[model samples]
Target chain A: MDDTTARHTEKMRRIKAARDEMMKTKTEEKGLIIVNTGKGKGKSSAGFGMIMRCIAHQMPCAVVQFIKGARATGEATFLRERFVDECRLFVTGEGFTWETQDRDRDIAAAQNGWEIAKAQILDPDIQFVLLDEINIALRNDYLDIDEVVDFLLTQKPHMTHVCLTGRNAKPELIEAADLVTEMTLLKHPFRDGVKAQKGVEF
Target chain B: MDDTTARHTEKMRRIKAARDEMMKTKTEEKGLIIVNTGKGKGKSSAGFGMIMRCIAHQMPCAVVQFIKGARATGEATFLRERFVDECRLFVTGEGFTWETQDRDRDIAAAQNGWEIAKAQILDPDIQFVLLDEINIALRNDYLDIDEVVDFLLTQKPHMTHVCLTGRNAKPELIEAADLVTEMTLLKHPFRDGVKAQKGVEF
Candidate 1:
């Protein structure tokens, strides 16, 4: 063999050995409680991507929007219209906090949303549940973190994966999550006076 | 008006005024250079989500994978099988750095992938272009950053939205980007001895 080919083969051998060692310890299979939080875009978008992944796997899923209101997002319209059997969508908020300044009304919306989320979590056929913007509701104290955590711990099916997406995720929720990602804002067009566009932001 | 009704109306009036002011400043429409990079997961997954968004809008799109090998990823499989007319998939890498173990081969792969990506960027029919893991290739010196940036600036269609996803994005790229998100790793299941699952990871 040539020198370059021999060196490459040797390098791959070392990598394979290390990978095998890492793979040996990764044998557990269970549902994941994933949290996507921080001050950046794409948290809910990522959650929606996971729902699409579930659909690709032919697994049923549901989405509950907590603070985005009844306005038709591109995701909501597409998922509801195209994948009816695979997705059950509920847009449960009047709007954002500033848009709906009444705390009592926001609280009632959160409570109503939680009930639907709870039902989806208990449904055996639904393998994936996306609680879109639930973190913001939790951050605003619209929903009790303890109640949410308790239900997530005790009632979720063993193989049912749940993802919560929004900024300011509660520490208690983070502590209970199996995976957490914080989308850090490096730059945003809105800061430079660009508006959110259809299909891109919605 | 009753006390509660009067308060609610006032709150909505304030909200409407703020929204109107914000809307007045957001009138420009152009293509976006979006970057997703960091040490956390979901960079490429989020890019795939954008492809889905484009599909939902009935806009044509293309994805060129730079570091991920020509394996049958769930996103690739589903997109190719279902959205044949809307998506153009190109898997141009043999594998990751360790898997390939040859810098020259890696560079060649990146170059070839960039050619495909360039064509897609200039295609007016394709509204969205996803350069999945191209940032890692650039970080590894598999491709020239200046050439990529210049091409992105000069040749991209007026309305084509391009997304680049990977870790260690170049500073120059971030500066040129319209939107940038850094996915921070808070907790990963791999660190906790959980294996990557089919639907979630692939």
Candidate 2:
């Protein structure tokens, strides 16, 4: 082999050993509070993917999309049509806060959505609950962060996994999260005058 | 309404108008080269999510996982059992390049895997392709980036959407991509002694 390749092979050997050693010590499994936030895209998509992962194992899952996103997103349609046996979806809010045009109106809409989310989250039958875009509600103070976190951490079943997706997640929520991934937008097509397409942006 | 609420609503109204105007100018639809990369957790999940989005529209899809991650992950099993009519999965590689312990062996496996991927990507029947963890192969020189990009951009059909997921994506690949998201790992359960769960990690 070439010189660089031989060196890389040697380096990979060390990394492989380290990873193997680290992996052996981990044997504990618990429900996770996974948060996907930041200004980048893919948060909701990743959350939906996690739901898909659960449905793969025949595990019961639910999705509660807070704020907007109720106008027939691609994921919502797909889930309703294909995985009805394993999944339930709730796309909440009349519109975004801006569209609602009033603070009280926005909160009232979100509170209504939260009632359904609370019931599904606390339901013992559900194993994975994707709190889709609920972060936006929390960020805008439409939902109380402490109350939401308390239910997720102390009230929810030990085996229940929750993934919260949206931008501008609260700092307290991040601190309490077991997994937090920020989807950073490196480049977007809209800047180049391209529009969101079906089966892609939806 | 309160003074603060009135001010915020006014600002939102203006912003909403701008958005409505910008959205109308976009009517183009083309195949996209989407790249998800970074030291984050949701890269693959988001890619899988996009695949799910397509499935929502009943678009044909295929997933080709590179490097490792072929030990019966949840998504792989789920897609195979449930979406046989909509999707196909091809998992390649004996192990990671490190596990292979030989550079040539790694390349051979990657090349073998690429053949399957190229076939699926070029296939007119498929609308979306997820090249799961392929950035690893390109980063390690297991496959040539230029050739891959050329095929994805030129040879592949216009309606075909491809998502390349992994860390350390090449500059050329990123430059050619339509959407690029970096999954920044802010918090991981492994750091706090928690193990990867079945549905969450897989």
Candidate 3:
């Protein structure tokens, strides 16, 4: 081979070798759980980004949105309409508690959402299961944190990842999570008395 | 009823109506794909129960097993594996192509695995990208489909998922798929292959 050809071949070989090492490292990586809490917007959005990242890798995922009822935001609506069977999406509960102050009813709604979430979370097939707004529900007493934690711990080890989002995350939930993120509320449109805009908050 | 009880009752009634109207319809559900193609025995076994059925209730689905990776002894494995990700795993492609000669390597081996796969199929965030029994590197020319497909497409689309399993799935892949399955065929331990194992071959 000519000198130029030889030089190019060496460079290509080195690049391929480096890439091979990187691919091996990535394949060996394990799944994880992320908790996005604190008073702020985009906590769920951040979690959604992670979800997108996994999907890019063809990882099957499930999202169980707790305590978010009939108010169809942009994310829930798109997921519900587009995510298909590969990534399971469940939106349960009766909106926020303030909107529906019936403790008994809220608890029932929470239980219903939890029932679906329990099955998804325990399933080893799911790479990641997003329990959107779960942290807030636990703090508000809509769902029992003790039971939820117990269920999470008992799931089949490995092959299943979990993500929890929402505000007022209890200390216990944060402690149990693998990766905890606090989305501190700096400022939001709601502060200016403006309602949620389409495609942004939803 | 007391004033508070009456108010709570009315609130629940409203919530119920909203939930009823917001319930997702069957046609509105998203679709998923699960492939059980590989040279190993457990490709289907691992995939069937893991992801297919977990999202069954959340949405409708279909399964296409590209090839019968295993013989006839793994029926139970297939049956049990048909949990969360079942409906999506369809067995098509004609049992392990390596045993046949039609298998040709149209693509180059050195090229990244993700590059070729990205050239055609676009949705990497697909709920499940199950490419069963796809390892033909040793048997045929290395086309590197796995690397290409997994790299460009195997992304976690806003809750989408993907899973791949096989004996020879290349380590240096183009796609850093979210979930990957590697089915190992241990000692057959059978005496000269006495009539193949039942429920295990399919």
Best by DockQ: 2
Best by TM-score: 2
Native-to-model Cα distance after best TM-score fit, residue A139 in candidate 2, in Å:
1.4
Q: Order the candidates by DockQ, highest first.
A: 2, 1, 3
Tens digits of lDDT, candidate 1, B171-191: 989988999999999999988
RMSD of each: 2.5, 2.2, 15.0
* Residue range A1-202, candidate 3, lDDT tens digits: 6675466556656666775565454433334445666554445655664554444445677888877776765555545655576578887877776567576777777788889887887777777788888876788677888887777766635646677778787777766655555543323333233333232334
Preferred candidate (lDDT higher): 1 or 3: 1
Q: What would you estimate as the lDDT of candidate 1?
A: 0.86
Chain B TM (all candidates) = 0.93, 0.92, 0.48
Clashes of each: 0, 0, 81
Reference contacts reproduced by model 2: 0.75
On lDDT, the candidate that comes out on top is: 2
- Model 3: residue A173 alpha-carbon error in angstroms: 1.1
lDDT of 1 by residue, A1-202 (tens): 7897678778877987899799899998888999999997778778877777777778889999998875667788778777888889999998887776677888899999999999999998888899999998899788999999999998899888999999999999999999999999999888677778665687
Question: Alpha-carbon error at B150 in model 2, in Å?
Answer: 2.3
Alpha-carbon DockQ of candidate 1: 0.54
Q: Per-residue lDDT for B10-62 in model 2, tens only?
A: 98888889888998877677888899999998898898898888888888999
